[model samples]
Target: MKKAFKYRIYPNKAQQALLQVTFGCCRFVYNKTLDIRKKAYETDKTKLSKFDLIKKITPLKEEFPWLRDVPHVCLPQAVYNMDAAYQNFFKSGKGYPKFKSKHRSRKSCKFPSSHCAVLQDTSHLKLSKLGLVKYKKDREFAGVLRHIVVTQESDGRYYASCLVETGADAPEPQPVEASTTVGIDLGLKDFIVTSDGRKISNPRFYATIDRRLACLQKHEAKKTKGSKRRARIRLKINKLYVKKRNLIKNYIYYVAKTLLRESQTLVMEDLNIVGMVKNHSLAKSIQNICWGELRRVLEYKSQWSGHNLIFIDRWAPSTKTCSHCGFHNSTLTLSDRSWVCPGCGTHHDRDINAALNIKRMGLASLLPAVSGFDGRGEVGYGLDEASICTV
Candidate 1:
């Protein structure tokens, strides 16, 4: 069982500068290599290979002498990045890699850390050429690290992820209390509505912090791009984002723990959030819910705890179907929070109804029940009475 734990790092000021420089150089190299590969593949048919990229490193170093002091593996990593890009491009994953912006750029660097390597808890990690440096010690996990990723976010926070090998097999579970099944509905009005009748309110966190964020953005926009003042504002904006992120992460952890304590099986709607966000009206609200983040935490925590996390499809109409009477509303509107089923004449509290149906739908899909009963959890095009209740 291999697992990875990522922890935020608080490096000293000097370390921060070194990281920024290294990140910039790596980003430049990655883009350059990708560009070269793109042109080559377009002009000729040969695929860019990682080994070939390493062969070119010597000539590259001669042309860019400053790179000699940097980590040797970085060049190869850049090539690997291009190979990955080509694979993705071929698979229609995303648009080609474009020139990175100074402020709105992606920021991450990877260094090879193999299994059986010596590392310390709360001690320095040695990168090639870069000397061992102090880092903030955080909780360690139950695995031998196979890789480490150092990332600097737009907000200027650093993180180190240790990809570890726990073992080839899963460990026996510790004793726990008897558990129950839960169906969850993630939304804007409520963070989540569970089949067990849990209504976790959507904390309008960004709504609370939006003004300050807007102010910071305005200040940042006033400064010249790449100027020290712009950098300062950039840092300020990043810190605000970090704070919100931490708050959301903590809340999610707390929620997952509470739910796992009671439930063995988690039934949830597999929402197309990225697609949902495409609607201009719901974009901000969608980002605030961080539904995707919550689901990821739920999945990993369930895996760690030996619980089943079932994702229902987004096509089943968990919302439009009446949980009590099994009646379907063919034309339920978004504004119709409360609705009555024409066939069954049953009144529904939209969200609660959705939660109940989800619970029913999930059970139907995942469990074997008597006739006329289906699973309580479902996710699909709520666009057509395909709605999951807001509960």
Candidate 2:
């Protein structure tokens, strides 16, 4: 298993200058290599191989001697990173490789520990050409260090992300407590409603800062380009963004932690957030919920903590069905918050009913395989199919 731990680092003025040089050189190499590859592919149908790119480095250094000022290890790593990016794009159908900008791109350099990257002690990191830098060691990790990525955030803070290779595979999923199963329905009105009837309010962190953010952005726009005032406003906007992100992250972690602690088996609806965000009316509120981030956090944490996380299909009629009677309400509109079931005369709260339906569907899916419920929905054990909620 591999994990990364990031900590704040304080580099001296000389080291900062050296780091800036490295950042620039690495960015230059990445952009140049990408441009060369794209042009060659377009003009001559030639894919510039990594080896071919490496072969040009000598001539490149001779033409541009300033590249020699940074650590020798960083230049080749830049080529490798670019190659990896292209490989990822081709393999995953991600966006095409794009040029990096010094002002817009993240300032980062990765150094493999085998090549002049080391930890002198718990509180210090040493890199080639750059002396031992001081960092806060608030937590300890047990593993062999593989690589370290030093990043300069937009807010002018430095961080070092140490990747460690733990000599073990990730723990396998364990059997969950059947009594602790839960289903979650995510929404904007309430952040999440559970099948068990618990609701967590949406914090709306971004909404809280929207007015100030708009003011800062407008102020930044009025300032002349390349002026000190524009730079100052940009820094202020970046800081506010950083603060907002941190707040959301902290709240997400807390919520995920609490949910995982309570439920051993958790189920959530598979939402099409990218499609949903296209609606101009609800886009801001939808983004403010941060459902994607919440889902991501729950997924990894569930795996690490031996909990089961399941996603029901996005097309499931959770919101339009009566959970009590399994009756699908075709005429139910988004505006209807509460409704009465025609089939069973049961009243349902919109979000809570949706959560209950999700839970029922999740249990149905899991139970059929585990409890010998056959294709015809018949249980071998004389028990009602609905009674065995095994998710």
Query: Once superposed on the true structure, which residue ranges of model 2 sit more than 4 Å away at CA?
Result: 116-122, 206-208, 276-289, 369-391
Backbone clashes in model 1: 27
lDDT (Cα, tens digit) per residue for candidate 1, span 159-192: 7777788876654443221126667776446778
lDDT of each: 0.68, 0.80
Q: Model 2 — which ten-residue stretch has the worst lDDT?
A: 372-381
Model 2 lDDT tens row, 243-283: 88788788889999999998878988776766665757644
- The C-alpha RMSD in Å for every predicted model, in order, reads 5.2, 3.7
Evaluated with lDDT, which candidate comes out highest? 2
The segments of candidate 1 whose C-alpha lies over 4 angstroms from its true place after superposition are 10-17, 114-118, 171-179, 224-227, 282-289, 340-347, 367-391
Which pairs clash in the backbone of model 2?
Answer: none
